[model samples]
Target: MAAARSATLSHLISTNEPPSLFEVAQLRRCVQTLVPRARLLWAEYKGLEERLQLCRIVLSPTRRLPAEILIEIFSWADKKTLLSISLVCRSWNASFNVVSSKSLSTTTMRFISEDGIPCHKILSWLAKPVTGTKTLNIEHEVSYREIRCKCFKPANPCPWAAPDFLNLLAKNPTPAQMVLRLKFSSPNCLSRLVGGAGNSLLWNSLETLHLQLTGNWSGRASIYRNALDGLPKTLRNLRLKINNPKDRRQPPPIEVPEAPFNTLKSLGIECSWDSPLILSILRLCVDLDVLIVDESIGRHTWTESAAQVTLPKVHTLRVKCLYLHESEKIFPLLHLPALASLTIDGGEVPFADRNWVLARSLRPLGLLSPMPRICLRTLVVQSINGLDGDALWDIFSHLRFLRCLVLQRVPFEGAGFLENYRRRTEGGEHLLPALRMFELRDLDEKFDATSFLCFVKVHRHATTRRHEGGHERIQEDAPDGLRHISLRYGDCKESRKFEAVREELVSMVGALERDFGVVVQMTRG
Candidate 1:
């Protein structure tokens, strides 16, 4: 066997030309003659050489980075950078394709078409690779030229009229459930999109819809109604914002179907000057889990009777208005038995009003009810113009289950602002036993830091007393005990006051951490 192996090794080296069949046959015969260890070593050396070559290529600086790393770099880049990255090279182009496709998977397309329709190139780019976009926004701006041009030249197509674009959507049926948000400034463009001869049918697959009417909204209610009539059954969320400068000549109300959205869970509406239309929507979207109403669209009178209308089903409510008295009256009408969150902004309720009986009585009466006493877990109040400390204390004192409280742009200039806060934190008036998170924003320099520190100190002392007496001990850890404090100071141009305020805030945070072991985060804007 050893002699046979030696003969095979000699045959292998004896080939002058690359091995032919006969040479390979002779080498195999020789391998049968050699010991097993030499054969194994020869095979292993070939494998090592191949691996070393691969490693050199991988570690070479001139070699292109892996596709995954390139994609990450693109993700961190902005839109302009994304465009530039696409132009780099062939490998980069392929990498960009994969990265851009993934990035646009949840992308929102918002068109500002006041100047003109989005160029065809943009539409073509969107239709390619079919990246399954989840949201589409189209905002059209109307101007004097656009109105006059369309009126005089009826034959000429308006720049924003893109039936072809809508058709493109039909061609590439993206699998993602989508949200279509459209803001239109031109009534002509709106009519073209949703009128009798419009393309409302293209929105058949939408899961969420948001519409904002900015220009000539009065006469366009018919157009909107027609558009809504074609809304897809899959829609689960809806938001409408209408701002009509010509609201003085009241437009005829659009008769919307009650509970227009059978599967809808969220609804938001912002109208400049009308409540009847808003009321119609509220009555129709009965099964909504979230509702938002913004009254800054325009000034209009709203009454308590409006809230009396039964809501189908709602678990969360957010209201932003300038009138607190009117808002208070409406709160009782909301049937939100399952509500776990409530937010109020710019309400007129006097912070010191001691009318707990009235306030409690106003809780919605019906199958839909506010959560049971202490069931509400989150409450936010912001931009309240007239509420003082006493009024806020009175309101907050009753919220036994509130775990988070946020105050923003709250006017604390009233006569007894500080005093009322002190009273609430004192032994007899202390409330919010379950409160774990507190946030304050847009506070003036003088009171921002000092007042906050004082409040924290009072609460800390009260908590210590509870622990000492063997009562239900308050937790020492934040959120668990009362964990986080967040403060956002509004931008003040006065540098001197800003500096002083910063110093005071630093001192306040230091004291809290040193004494109570609470975590505080401060943000300046």
Candidate 2:
């Protein structure tokens, strides 16, 4: 055996033969003789090289992008793709946080024609707050768990109990803003949140608090009042809307949350203008800066408390109603000296003349006096009966700095503002002395074209201001020069019928362009 191995070792006859255990034992002993520290260093070097190569192949260039850029890139991605990217890692999860983070704004929602949806399921799901979410909007149609309402079945009253809301509030106490709009099938509804139970995080730190109730509001007035009072007092904006389908014959007592609405800066209420709730809120929200009233005057007889309410800081007031009679009543209470923008619209209300209200209520306020306190810039008025010319004059006389004027569905009566300006010229004072943009709409064949022409001529001249310091120095915004006059005639057929009148209007427009360098347009309303 020794002689045969000797021959194999020398490769004298080693074809188809394997090495013996003695050869393997010698190789093992050689490896065992290496230095321990050298082996460890070699192992580490190989491991690190492998890791670097793996990183080179798998690491994404997108990972090096800044978070803001990454977010923008992800924003353009589809929803499913965005979700997939979010699950990549914790940092990426945070980078593309869309609905999951503070970028989500407070929104309003409404669901119409919805049948039996499990209110508890929805409330429970919403109550499980989306982390870092800012506002939760439950627009409409919430119901109880396991209970279905077939809206098609008239026999099923689908009366949802109040306890479901309690369960939702109990489970998911909101830490951010939540817009709650409730419409109940019956007179009964959830009364209030649990008296003293909530997350440590205050819910009132929200940017806005909106509550709208549209069912049998009268029957559940106390319930709503309790809910509102129990709400947090840290809201910055509040919008309350109530719609009652029942006749105004037996109006219920107005109920709103008792305040120290200390943080509320903006308030919009769509209840009756004479609602006690509105008065109560006004008395509480002293720091309000924006107020919009879109309500009709109810049967509220002014009591002693009504005289004390005042909104001191409101600058923008927009009144939208079908009737101006309520506005007439509202104007007396709103002695807003700081008012800058006023919009009043009598939308589809018969016998609603907003100009009459303005003339009646504003005249005594020393409005448009030689030295006026209110510096109004924008005025928008709309009505059906057409504004009385004297009424328009009375309102315009009070405005010296008015820049934009929009009149809708209101015709010019008597002598126009320019005609009045021409007659009552005392030291270069023109009608709407600083007017820039004049927009009128929905004038029928009965509209006075001559009055409109006069309006354009006067406003174009007034738009160019002269300075005593320089020779013919125009105003800073003189380039516009009353070029933004837009008029819409309600009846295109009428304009076609009165071809001569249409040509006359076109001639006037052409004259404006040629002489004053102003562009005027007429369109069908």
Candidate 3:
């Protein structure tokens, strides 16, 4: 009788019913009555009973999913869903803690508050062992002096002062795969952070480092040199940018150690002037594969002086000059046997003087004698005032292996420039042999009818021939033939000229497609 009554109670509880509060109460009483001895059983196995009751209430097959499966489900969810899951119950909270620990491991902590309050919280969090942190980026704006004042205050002295964050880093070293960006308002703060008691600890595990120094502080290079002198030998990449004039005046000449970074592969530096100083620093990075020098100071003359410095092994070089004079000497530095790409900005070559720049620029290519066939595949030329289209065409003609050519503010002074361009290439069978992409920006309506037309016609005709080796050798009847042009026109201010230029460009593209069967795209600014 007791067994039959217990079975009956189980069936009633398991059924999917819209039971009232009274019905639920009566059901509980009936179940208890069915198994009076169950009270003793329940007391002896209280945890199991509670779990069984919870399973019936929340995990029954007729209802929803089981807790374990739901936990796994939440694990696959994104940050938003996980946050929502955390609010459900104690079980979910614990589950969330486990998943969150793993998910947040990839995030770097950034303290953005200007005041010291956030700094304290960050320090507290960092004080604990960060076993899972892969990268730590600290972009706090708090001044070191402020932190020192607060931590060293007498009223309620904190044992872990501002510098303790560094100390903690030193004491509990993270894995060597971590990357760090430590930006500071002043060099002094950077010095304090790196050279303090935590100095040895913080840099030991760093694999990549980026430092941006801003504000009124001077002597950043000195501070950086001192702070980074003993950095981990494992550093693979380094980027340094000093924007403040005060700081630029005092950049200490980098004292690169012999094989300073045994594993360093890339180095990028942006500052004003100090080209010789920069050259000296670059020599130390013997194994460097990429080098970017963006320093504009002291009239264009500085560039000429900078160009005199030699970089023999650099594979990639990007230079932005204020004046065009220095550009004349860039070719002589092409001792780089492996140079594959080159970019120059803010240089203007006159229509009459274009050949001079081209000849000198090509001198470096000549230096690679036995391998005179240098595989220089990409070239970017940006002119501030404008480049004479004829001179540009002449320049492109010489770069036999040039694959990409970009012209900024190319000057098309009416029919003269276009006629000169056409006259030079009229008899020549080929143009930019390896050129596949061409871009022209900041042009006027005249550019569309003359300069654009001449380029398309010359290259289109040349490419149709079988023997043509330049950009002109497009496959006959092939849809992918030579001309793929992007033209950008217009000034910042609005003008009626815009509509005229657009119409001209549309007509030019239509003619090219209809007459030459070439595709051209026009985009307006």
Candidate 4:
């Protein structure tokens, strides 16, 4: 047997013939087995090099500088640079602390690692007392384990229920504003963090709160019910956003607060809410000065007995998404007596639905009613489809006090709107006489630039002649002229036509700017 093995080894060592496939496979397997070990060695080598570089930095003569000089250098550095340099050595960390302690007005706490590991260091640091922090932002993003374990489905509590953080918040001077963003893993998680049972005085002095709640919260409206139970009276501005999950489960309704949030002056909602919840919230905001509704105003149905909500003090109202199917129910529910600025953004419409005019949906209710004559000063309408010439005239003729007008993606018929406007101005009518600024953006292929320029010339000529005799010829209520005019349109069909008439448009706009002192900004694709 020994002689056979020797013969085999000698043949394998000195054979001229190519090896079999089995031998090739064995060799590949051996190479694969060493890959991880090689990686480990490379990592160790890199670590050693880093440590040697750190040693060199420590032994350099720069380390011998006085603490006062170091403190001055640290003071000049920004927050990110100071943090990076603090990791070099203990003395640098000490210097950074000295600078940070004096100028730390904002503190942000991120309590979890990205890949699902618990940040034990941050958890331990949360136990220390923090003072003089005017703004505190705490955010916990979704973790890998939470995704892999499907923790959003089960009622399992997240591990980072830091009671110590709540205690620290209570110990410090009350922050003027606090922003909290977290996922609702379980009710207990929020109960221990900021709920009523967490700390009684946590929000006593807070004036502004921006709360963003996100999760697969299809059947968990109770989470919001418990979370918003104990708001501070000093909160004057509240921005709430709930990122809705893609599901069809109609979550159970949450109860509205018995008492109103009378101190809230500005409210912005960025998500869809049930009708009852939205109505309740608006009813409480009596002093709301600015209101922004980014998403749908209401998601569910409303009964016949649902009363209209009156926001008497809302001066600036922005309705970002106006679905034609739902606009009828939405517009009649609000009565804003003091509305001054309005933005109606009708987001992209399908090709098949090009004839749905907004005039049909804008009923004579709320601020659109003509009897009392809403003193709307600024009007912005964008991305609207099927707004014909007559409907456009109907909407614009009522705004006698409009100072700024912006229209985009409005495909009016031929030159109808502009012709009517010019004839009215020439006939000594007072429609939009107070207009000071007009902006047109992203016009469709149906736009008639020649007609528009004619209107502009007529309007400018009329207004410039108002003070020709060194005295005001027009009414005192009307403005002198249009101070600013911006025309921008870009699309496939319009781009071709724009190139054909680009030079003429530029020359005309320049003359308007030079003669009337009007700021004309014109661009075409």
**Winner by lDDT:** 4
Please count the clashing residue pairs in each candidate, in the order shown: 21, 3, 6, 0
- RMSD to true structure for each model, in Å: 13.9, 16.5, 15.2, 17.1
lDDT of 1 by residue, 1-525 (tens): 568656756775787657668657867776676668787899999999999999997787745678888777778888888788789778778878877777665444444435455646445545555445545556555554543224113465654456666655555543465566776654344445543223344456667778776555434344445434545566788887766545465544555654346567898877655456665566667678898877643434554256454554676778765433334334455555566777766544345532332233224322113344326677776655555466566666666666888878765542354556566556466556667788887866655466656676667667566656866533443233456787776766576776777676687788788888777886666
- Which tens-of-lDDT digit does each residue in 1-525 have in candidate 4? 446545655676897877567666655665687799999999999999999999998798888998888998889999899989899889888888877764554556554433332334434433444444345456665566653222333464344334454544566544433443344333334443444223446556666777665555533566545545565676777776655443545544555453326667788776564445566677778888988766563444655355888889999887666344445555567788888898777675454554453453344333335654467788888778776665676667667677899887766443676677766767666456578898888864446766776567677777666556444443565677788887786663655676666555677777777887777776774
Backbone clashes (count) for model 2: 3
lDDT of 3 by residue, 459-505 (tens): 66655553444344333433333557767775524556666666656
Better of 1 and 2 by lDDT: 1
- Of candidates 4 and 1, the better by TM-score: 1
Q: How do the predictions measure up, each by TM-score?
A: 0.62, 0.57, 0.54, 0.60
**Model 1 RMSD in angstroms:** 13.9
Q: How do the residues 2-27 of candidate 2 rate in per-residue lDDT, one tens digit apiece?
A: 56445655772456566568855654
Question: Which of the numbered candidates is closest to the native, going by highest TM-score?
Answer: 1
